[model samples]
Target: MYQYDEYDRALVFERVAQFRDQVERFQAGELSEEEFLPLRLQNGLYMQKHAYMLRVAIPYGTLGARQMRTLARIARDYDRGYGHFTTRQNIQFNWIELEQVPDILQHLAEVDMHAIQTSGNCVRNITTEAFAGVAADELIDPRPLAEILRQWSTINPEFLFLPRKFKIAICSAREDRAAIMMHDIGLYLYRDGYGQMCLRVMVGGGLGRTPILGQMIRQGLPWQHLLSYVEAILRVYNRHGRRDNKYKARIKILVKALGIEAFAREVEQEWQHIKDGPAQLTEDEFRRVAEGFEPPAYQGQGDDELEYGSHLTMDRAFARWASRNVHPHKVPGYASAILSTKPGPSAPPGDLTAEQMEAVADWSEQFGFGEIRIAHEQNLILPDVRKRDLHALWRLACEQDLGNANIGLLTDIIACPGGDFCALANAKSIPITHAIQQRFEDLDFIHDLGELSLNISGCINACGHHHIGNIGILGVDKNGSEWYQVTLGGSQGKNSALGKVIGPSFSAEEIPRVIEQIVATYCAYRELDEPFVQTVQRVGLEPFKERVYARAPEVEPCAI
Candidate 1:
């Protein structure tokens, strides 16, 4: 993980002091809510249903043991004993008191972390592949580029107040685990034919009221021009992006309105003037960032036979967890273990209790590298666990009910804290997710369903990425009643596609059955080992829709 330099520390602490003053003024009635909104938002504080919520950025979702321990401390001492990990790899404390935010920020700064750009109409957290450096299939480590972008975007005066909040994700692996297609700016780092590293820029991609897969604007762009090119895109959007209506403010909306060709032309025209400017990265700069991400010291056992295999054979439960939770590591005789946050009913998706956080911190060092990663799928990753230690790590994970073997399964749901926490949510998301999770708690049955994704957002904002889940669920408000809408055929990857609505929204009580029907339909039509998504595409939404709408009413559906 990249350690903060003096300049970085100064900036973060200085910002914290400034925010402390802002909060003081707002409390003293020196600043109105209107005047204080932007300031608080810039600091990643939001007014939720019960109290303030503080979102702390886990930049590109990388954290060391010290940082993780600090986060656990914050959760234990300040807010409730748990924090919610978001899809963006950020963590949110939902019960934050307005007065203690400064203290929280100070504590975060102490661990080289901050809440900057986690929210508001600016470049949010610069996310990348969670297993960037450790993925065996990676072309290059995307974390350095992600960190460079993070530094470039942080407090970049030109983009601080864009027309709308912008999100950027970088991916280097063949699999698009970062959901590159659903970001305001998606950069896929790859090597060209000549064997030089470059970026494939995709712009105008986002999900909300309007969902659009990013269009490829620039391909084979030299990695050195990353900052310059990003500046050009932001400049174009800032100058022409709509300001009149918040709904039409995202860069994706602007890109859609202007067509890819014209948009690319404008960005190119803008880039020509600034291509060699101060922002153009230098070889030394790349070296400096790359040094921080050098490969960890390995034991060099090279896929040797180990007790881990014996343990797997002896313990069915451990084997089950290992099969789904463990992923291949770049280094030999090592693995990347996913600690599932989705334990069903007991814990909400992407949530961790203070004790659990501390345990994970201990496990990160005890198992592999002294670092942890938060995947876009709302799971925590121990990036380089030695294969021999899988059983021990699994035992530690099982302590907090985090040993569920449901990664990428139907019960491994991606969900947002809807009406339960978010003020903007139309319905309660956690309860519904729990309801569905309880209905499908059978691990064997869930595995039988095979490689499924179900995402739920409290509103059309798509915070849960409901637009990209194999089965997307959105909470709707119909005459003050909580209704749930379902979308199918959505996925995130090379073949990313937005989900299509099946029918009218169903009530909370009816949603679990609706999902069951959809699953049954997929199981009936699937051939061989085809995944749920392939079956949906092959047979179209008609089969699922027919089974779903049989009980659905004629009411209009929520346009998620």
Candidate 2:
């Protein structure tokens, strides 16, 4: 994890004091609601459905055990007893009082954390794969470059106010776990044939009202020019992007209107003058930042496969959990385990109570190094657990309700705090998630289904990344009634695709059965061990749609 220096601490504390004054004025009636809107948003405070919600940034999804403890403490003492982990690798606290937010920010600053750039139309948090440094297949760690981006973008005067919020994701591995294809700017860090690390720059990708995969604007860009190149792209968007309508203000909209070739031309023209400037990263600077993310002191314990395999043979339940939740580590005798937040038939997706948070922190220190990670899928990760301790860790995780083995299965849902907490939501997302979880509570069935991602969003903002889910569910409002629209065949990763709507929206009560019918149709027609998305792609949506809407009257297919 990157520790905050004196400058970082000063900037955060100063912002906290400024926001404290602004909040005091707003509460004292010196500032109107309209006047306080942008100010509050810049500080990551939102006036949600029932109360204020505060989003705190967890940069690159890395957290030290001490920071995790502070988060648990915050959840225990303030607002509610739990917080919602978001797709942006951040956390949101609902039911926060307006006046207490300053104190909260102060508390966060003490731990080298803040709410800065978590919201509003500024470059938001720079995210990447949670398993960056330790992934077995990574070409190079992207965290050092991500940290550089974080430093350069924070309060940069040139882009303090863009037409819309900008999101950037970097992926070091070929697997694309960071969902780089669906970001405003996506960078793939890889070593070229020359053994030089270079970036594959992507532009115009985003999900929301208009979902589009980013086009590769530049390839084999030298590592040192990362900042200058990013600046050039942002400059083009800032100059040419629309401001008349919020929906048309994103860079994706601009890229579509002008076409990628023209967009690249513009960026190239701008880069001509800035490419060799001071903004171009230096080798020394790279080494300085890279030092922060250097591999931890790993012991040469050799392989623990013998002991681990014995435990797997002894316990079928543990084996099942390990199969789904564990990932391969780069080091021998170590593994990265994902602790599923989306347990079946109960607790809301992404909601972790204070006690659960503490338990995770304790477990991270006990089983691995004192470090933890948050995946974009809304799960916790212990990145360096020894293979020998896998059984002990599994046993404790089961006790904490973090032992669900459905990592890529149907029950491991990605959802946002919809109408239940967000004013922008059309319908409540938690109940819908609960309904689907209850319907597919069987682990054997989920595991057999294989590699299914079901994401639900309350509205079209795509906070849940529904557009990329294998089975996407978007909550809709029709004539003041709550309904859910379904989309099938959406996928994230190397072969990413946006899900297409199967048909018209269905009532809340009909969703669980509709999902069941879709699954049943899949089970009936699928080839041996064919995945859900592959089946949908191979057979087309007609069979699943017919089964899902078999009893309904004729209705036009919806698009989202």
After superposition on all CA atoms, what RMSD does each candidate show versus the true structure?
A: 3.3, 3.1
Off by over 4 Å in 1: 302-304, 551-560
Query: Residue 303: error of model 1 in Å?
Result: 8.1
lDDT of 1: 0.91
What is the C-alpha local distance difference test score of each model? 0.91, 0.91
TM-score of each: 0.97, 0.97
Model 2 lDDT tens row, 296-315:
88777565888899999999
Range of the 10 consecutive residues with the lowest summed lDDT in candidate 1: 551-560
